[model samples]
Target: MNKKTVKDFFDNLAKDWDSFEQPDSAVIEKILDYADIQIGCSVLDIACGTGILFPYYLKRNPLSITAVDLSEKMCAQAEKKCTDKRIKIICADILDTHTVTDKAERCLVFNAFPHLGNAKDAVQALCRHLVPGGILTVAHSESRESINNRHKEKAFSVSEPLPSASDLADIFSEYLEIIHVFEDESVYIVSGRM
Candidate 1:
């Protein structure tokens, strides 16, 4: 799908996005656990609609967080969800590198991978913001196979298939080291260190 179509789809869903697509807390916990975020580290949550992962990140008591999303209404909702003064939310496209800053301790892409037009570009943008030795995680509330099947069923244009754990490792080979790949009952987590 083109950027406009993707933007409209999400914009239309912004109001009920969270309730309509509630993530499994178990899956969320597992992904965050694998992240192993440390205190005082700056983290970025990409495509962070409604900031579902914000609460989990807050538990780690990070020094700060930067959340970005393409939909303005979604960002508004996330702003309400995230009350911490340290959190800064940006309403912008993930593919726009100009909107992202550099060298975060961790960067997270959760439940929003397939929606991206260029997964490689998105990954590269995140990498640009990750400190040397920083971590990056990509997770979903369902298994890769399940997520793929659901997208097919919905007739959503998946420009690129979500990468497998091994695929991700290869993609980030130059900039990161694969740390772990976890596939639980309802989620898949791919963690890497920069």
Candidate 2:
């Protein structure tokens, strides 16, 4: 989807985004567990709609966090939810590498990868920002097959099919080391070290 479409989609849902349907708590917990965020590392939360994962990450006391989204309203809501001084919210597309380059110790693309349209570009962008040995975790609220089947049933055209855990590992293998890949309930966590 284009920026306007993404913006409009999230803007209209900003207020109720958090309460919208989501992965189970167990799945969320599993994803967070795989994050392995340290005490003082910089983090970039891409497409962090409504800041659902901010509080969880904040509890780990990160040195700093930059939460980015294509929707201004969603970013505003996240800013409000993330009261920590260490947090900075940006209303911008995550695919814009120049907008957020070499700034994070870790990057998270949670429940937002499929919507990216260009998953490879998104993965490369995250790889570029991450420090050497840094971590990049990409996850979805559902399995690849489940997501793909949903898209097919709905007759929606994705920019590219959702990649399986092995698919992601192979794509980023040149730049990152696979750390973990598993599904918890419907959520699938793909962790790698850059």
Candidate 3:
């Protein structure tokens, strides 16, 4: 799908995006565990729709959080939800090298990877901003089949199907040391250390 089309699609739904999905706290805990977010470290929240995970990230007391999204309305929604001084919301594509100038200790792409134009290239770009030994996690609170089926039903031609856990692990392995891979009825996660 065209990048502009995807951005517009999400912009239309940004105001109500938080209501569309309720992420399970337990699963978020697991994902964060794999992320290994350290105290006082920098974080990059990619595709941070409505800042749904901002509260969770705040719990770790990170030094800074740079949240990026392609949709301006989505970024505005995130800004409304997260008023913390440590969080900086940017209305720009994280895949663009110039958009994020600083490296981060932890990077997360949560519940939004399939919409990327090129998943492999996106991962590579995210890895470039990851500090040595930092972790990057791509996760979905729902199962792969559930996410894919919903996209298929919606007929959003922009949405790409999520790969199997093992397949994603292999993809992440190209840029990071594979740390975790888990996919079950409830959730999908693939995390690696940079």
Top-TM-score structure, candidate number: 3
Give all candidates' CA lDDT scores. 0.79, 0.78, 0.87
TM-score of candidate 2 to 2 decimals = 0.88
TM-score of every model versus the real structure = 0.91, 0.88, 0.95
The candidate, 1 or 3, that scores higher on lDDT is: 3
Clashing pairs in 1: 103-129
Worst 10 residues of 1 by lDDT: 154-163
Judge candidate 3 at residue 9 and give its lDDT: 90
Tens-digit per-residue lDDT, 1-194, candidate 3: 68888899999998788786788999998888777876898999989988989999999899999998999999988888788999998888888778855789899899899888677887898899898998899989889998889998883676788889899899899999998899999888899998
Residue pairs that clash (backbone atoms under 3 angstroms), model 3:
none
Per residue, candidate 1 scores C-alpha lDDT tens digits across 37-140 of 76889988888988888888888899999998887878988989878998999888767756746468888888888887666676777787788889989888
In model 1, the runs with Cα more than 4 Å from the true position are none
